[model samples]
Target: MTDTTSVFENSPEAEFGDYVALLKPRVMSLVVFTALTGLLVAPVSVHPLVGFAAILFIALGGGASGALNMWWDADIDRIMRRTRNRPIPAGKVSEGEALGFGLALSGISVVMLGLAANWFAGAFLAFTIFFYVVVYTMWLKRSTPQNIVIGGAAGAFPPMIGWAVATGGISVESVLMFMLIFMWTPPHFWALALFMKSDYAEADVPMLTVTHGRKATRTHILVYTLLLAPFALALAATSIGGPVYLAASLVLNAMFIAGALRIRRRDEAAAEADGYRVEKRFFGFSLSYLFLHFVALLAEAGLAQFGWGGW
Candidate 1:
């Protein structure tokens, strides 16, 4: 079947699962995990129900962003092999339906967050959705190689919003958490770009690899990985930091740096010979790198609850 045939299939009506897929549940999981870590690691304690409600609303806000992003990027999604199976591109859901679903959830989440927690957190959620949908998806994704760099802020805001839910304001610790994700994003995405360069090129997305070439992208990956290590280490020095986080940071950053260096050392011929194995491996490792760092933070929080965790 032709690509158009696949995309325009007169398939059965979209099932509930198709709508769930539009929310990008995998990405939402990361948002939920990081946001939960933010809430749990805060210095102040919230009532259990209030804390649960805050996280739920924050998660809905995250889901809404994903839906809107998919809706906006549907054209490019249809072009890119990896994204071709998404609800919109697969003809499982219409773009208009996705847009409406996203906006409804966005309003519900923000307003409920305000009533359930505080307007500060609510406003932050609103802005997170806006940044992801309007700023990154609509503008930067098509405009520049630095799209990931500037757009990374939207993904990094979840922890800050979660913190606001607990404390009603931002703090050094919250910003540190944001920085951790921000710095890690370039290397993480660049690694993927190294392998998925063709996808970005075909979609006219202007990813670093497509615009600046692979060697520069590799160099950039190493540079950002180096820069990310210090941020991770510095977070371990904050009020949120402790022995657990420090030890985890040291190990994870060391492994991450090694991966980046491996990718940086290889030429395109070598990468082709190995089927971009090193780049793909590093891309896989990058996911675990961010996840483990926050897991360590969560462990620190657990220890602090028993009075064992502190600087």
Candidate 2:
């Protein structure tokens, strides 16, 4: 007989490292970098210490969202090969402890950001956390295959929030940054979904592949990739982008689009037989695509400081 009684009693007590793992630190790195880019590119200048504080608080908010997500998704995560080993699902942390930790950090991050930066940035950070945890994790995740598509907006908010920290307001540039990430999310995530469809199927999650089949998912990836190219290029037309950003966008999008096309051309059997190697490569390249784009934007900003590039 399965021992179903008082599992918590035997479960290891949650530790500091487990709590940290709940935060998904690697994902938080991208959040910090993109937010810093937005802050740097904004026309307004902030004190270095204040800018640092704002980015730190934004990162904490990202971590809070990640923890909350892990807490909520622990069930499906345990069933899925990709997420089976996360802290909560793998028995490293109790769900209750994760929930409490996430909630506390969410509150602390918002209040600290307001005190250290501005209320506008703080409020946006708060909303970002709420949207990710409540709107995305609680509402959208289990309900629809469009989960990542809509949930991506939460991830897209960091750069805008950082821009708000510097300018104390929103603008086209910040919105463009948000749009870039927003458009990038579908293709990026769908590629992984293509390669790992079995995991989602086993977890009973309504990922695109689970709800719509690999062929349909591949088509959707291609469609989103096509849509994303313009946004990637459009960023280069913004005040933030210049020679550096344009060059990066051109090269990255060319490769990304080509990869998507290749995926579209491959039959499911061929893809699976090869362990979806192309999809995996595309997924890895997509990570570089985003980071390189942001780095290019930063380089342009740096160049403009020396009167080298800008509108």
C-alpha RMSD of each candidate structure in angstroms: 3.7, 3.3
lDDT of 2 by residue, 90-184 (tens): 88888998889899999999999999989999999989998998999899988999999999999999999999999999987898899989989
The lDDT of model 1 is 0.92
* Worst 10-residue lDDT window, candidate 1: 4-13
Candidate 1 stretches with Cα past 4 Å from truth are 1-12
- Give residue 299's lDDT in candidate 2 (0 to 100): 88
lDDT of 1 at 202: 95
Q: Return the lDDT, model 2, position 101.
A: 89
- How accurate locally, in lDDT, is each candidate? 0.92, 0.90
Distance from true position, residue 55, model 1, in Å? 1.2
